[model samples]
Every structure is written in structure tokens, then in C-alpha cells.
Target: MFPTPIARTSSGTQIAYKIALPVALVLWLLPLIAVALTSVRSAGDITAGNYWGWPTSFNLLANYTAIFENTPIGKYILNSFKVTIPTVIGSVALSCMTGFALAVYKFRANLIVFFMFVAGNFVPFQILMVPVRDLTLNMGIYNTTAGLALFHIAFQTGFCTLFMRNFIKAMPFELIEAARVEGVSEIKIFWYVVLPLMKPAIAALSVLIFTFIWNDYFWATVLTQGADTQPITAGLYSLNGQWVAAWHLVSAGSIVAALPPVLMFFLMQRHFIAGLTLGAVK
Candidate 1:
């Protein structure tokens, strides 16, 4: 039922694949290219309706520098790091334990609980905005990084648990059984056996969660405001004047905000790929 690999396909099919590859890649990168181009264009170029055309001048350094000088982008970046890192760590760690319990231990409510995690993923988050915002306000952390991160952790854990449970389930059950026979404690088995095997998954989940949380503009806006707590995603709006929008600076800030996740993917590219394709071959 699976599609044949391109390497094993007929010559005409292979040629078609080769011709389509670059076209698809360029199409995918087109918007990013536009954003990058916009980031370097002069403000005059933007004002004079030169978007998507050749730039009159490249204000590369000036545009980048102007953002730092004229805005609180630096603090916004720090706030993003503070929020994203903790959320990724918290969500993944919680998922590992929850997934392990659900996968390795047979309990009466196992499927019911697992279904609950999966169910949360289907709920539309936009609908929760009012209540989540009101809840945060009541907790007196309505505009804090911790509040934002906590909400992200709670929301993300559901998906992370779904991801990790499947990975753990695919693991050989004999390892846990053998550990039990050897008088090894359950926690030790998880630590020494399952967790070691879960490195690829952990790395993959970390990168995914980091990107999601970093790029989360909606909740960032809903849960927090101002440079003190806002992530780079929402803080980009702060570049606007009351009467005017600085599209050039906003584009530059967007490019800047996107860098961390891109760098993160590149840094963990190997593990990330491995995690995704862990069981594909078999």
C-alpha cells in the first residue's frame, strides 16, 4: 500500500520527481524570501509601493540596528527564551512520565486517560481565549512570562503525551519485564533503560515545542503584553507607531524572531530526523 521510493521508480517517474523537487522547494521558500527581502528594503522603498520589486537600497545593518535602538526587541527576545525553554522542558518531562506510565503499566483507566489527552488536542484553542485570559487575571499573573509558560506547558502536554506514548509503546516490553525479574526498581528501569532509548524522541519533541512556543503570537498576545513579558512574536507589533506601521522594522523583527527556531532545527537536525523516522524502516 505504500508508495514506491523514488530511487526504485521508473525512469520517467524519477525524472518527473527530479524536475518537481526544486520547483516545490522554491515555492515553499517564496514567502520566507519575500520576508527577508522586505527586511532589507529601505523604509522609503516600502512607503513608495516597492514591495515584491527590486529594492532601491539595502539598509541591512541600519534596519537591524534601528530595531534595537528604537525598540525593546532585545528584552522581548530574552523573555521568549525564558518562556520557551521552561515550557519545552516542562512539557517533555511531564510527557515522558505520563507516557511511560500509560505505556508500561496496565491500568483500568489507561485508554480512557489516553483518550482524554488526545481529546484536548482536538479542542479549538481560540475558543479558550476568554476563559484562559480571565483565569490568568484571577491568578494575578495575567501578563507574566511564568503565566504564559505555564499555560503553554498545560496545553502542549497533551500532544507531547500522545507523541511519547506511541514511541514508548513501540519499545520492546521485554526490557521492562526483564528489569522486574532482576529486582530493578521501576524508576531505575525508566531512567536507565527507557529514557536512554528515548533520546531521539526527547530531542525531537524539544525542537518542536521550542518552535511552537517561540512562534506563538496569539496566546502571547492573549496572556501577556508589553516588552517585560511578551515574546518576540507579539513584541513585533510594538514596532508600530500609533498612526503608522513600520513594515520594514516589523519584517526585520520577524526575521530576527525566526532565527532561534531555525538555528535550533539545524543544531538538532540529526536527532530530529532520527526521531521522526525512528520506526519508518521497520
Candidate 2:
């Protein structure tokens, strides 16, 4: 059974919930608040060990500007876009077709094959790093945008398929049957009917995958090298001088790098909520 909502709970419980909410929220946001504070603090503030304290000076514009002027952050951001966009498109596209087949078609191996895709999600990706790296090296795409994007696409397809298959399976079979009676081909049925209906799911999944790939520092570092090929996640690590950590610049870059996914979630918030809340999917 689901837990009772605060509105339906006893007055004492409701009061506790109200009191706890802001406390928890502040606790959650403490680190982000620190980062934002750090991003604007002058370099002297950082050098003098002023972290988690009042800034001696604010270099909001200067800190932000220095990242663009002094580092390859712009290129790293561009590289993140290149990898993330293609991975989102590729994984979502593949999942739609595979989802339709696994959801609608009746076959002996359907569940088994579907389970195979689902099973991939459970495997620890860390274990596969060595082999996956070797795979890219052997394929001659190591340290390239294409290789990183391709790897993300493949790894993500498993989860995307699981998300989409359950969504498609919940769609009314009568719709597909209606299309067949109207002499519509399967491809058209999928393209015009199912795909049109899948917009919410696509939007939600795109946002999720975009956020995942964009924040993927682990894979970004493991699969690629240097600023030219690395995403903003890894590129943030490169913001330091040889002898210095330059935490302020890294914090500034962190703020810059976080903007896209935050904007993405806000833009797709409507569709993303709808996709998750649909009765069938729920």
C-alpha cells in the first residue's frame, strides 16, 4: 500500500511533514549552494581557504568569463552536445522499434529476448569498462566523439527498451487492430499511430538520456582522452593549472555545465511527468 499523503495524515503528522520538508530541502541543496557560492567567489577567496564561508569578493562575471577565455570549456561543452544528442536520438529510435516488436508481436522467444535486454540494465557497467575500452580501441574509434556516443547509445538502449516496451505494451491493441482493418501497413501504423502516441515517452526518455550522458564523467574519462574529445564532465577536471587545483574555475565550469540539463528538464517537465504518470505505464 502507498503511504498516506500529508494532506490526509493526522494534524501532528502533517505538521511534522511541513517542518521536515524545508529542512530536508535545505540539506539536499547545501552542496549546490556551496558550489554556487564558490562559483562567484574571487580567486583570492579560494586561495585564502574561504570555502563554505562569506566571499571576500564576487567575480561572478569574471569567473564565468575566465572559463571561456582561459580553457577549452566551450569545446568541451560542444563535445558533450555532440555525444549526448546522438546517443539520445540513436537509443530512443532503436528502442521504439524493438519495443513495438516485443510488445505487439507474439513469438516463442519474445519474453526471453525481452529479458535479455532488461538483464543488461542489471549488470554493473564498471565491470564492462575494461572490455568496452578494448572494444573501442580495436574498432579504431577510441578517444573520439563517435566512439563515446556509440558506447552510450549501446549501453542506454537496454534501459530505453525496457522503458518503451512497458509503455507500448500498455497501449490499446484495438488501435493496431483498427489500423490493420483499414489496410494500413505495419510500418505506417507504427510511424503514424504508435509514434505519434509515443511523443510523451520520447520526450521523457530523451531528457533522461540527455541528463545521463551529459553528466557521465566516468565514461567520459574512461573512453575518451584530452579536451578535444572529452565532454564537459571530464573537461571540468582539466580546468586546473599544473601546480594548482583552481577549485573556483572548476566550480564555475560546474555551474556552466549544469545549465543545459537543468534547462532541458524544465522545458520537458510537462511531457516527462505525463509519460511517468500515465495509467498504463504506472
Candidate 1, 1-282: lDDT as tens digits: 368789898999999999999999989999988889988999899889888998899999999999888789999999999999999999999999999999999989999999999899779988888999999999998999999999999999998898899989999999899999999999999999899999878988898889889999899989998889998888876655421557778788889998998998899988667655645886
lDDT per residue for candidate 2 within 127-218, as digits (tens), equals 99999999999999999999999999998999889889988998999999999999999999999989999887898889888888999989
- C-alpha lDDT of residue 219 in model 2: 90
Candidate 2 Cα RMSD after full superposition onto the native fold (Å): 2.9
Model 2 regions lying over 4 Å from their true place:
1-23, 240-245, 273-282
Q: Estimate each model's TM-score.
A: 0.86, 0.88
Best by TM-score: 2
Clashing pairs in 1: none
Show the lowest summed lDDT stretch of 10 residues, model 2.
273-282
203: Cα error in model 1, Å: 0.6
Candidate 1 yields a Cα-based lDDT of: 0.89
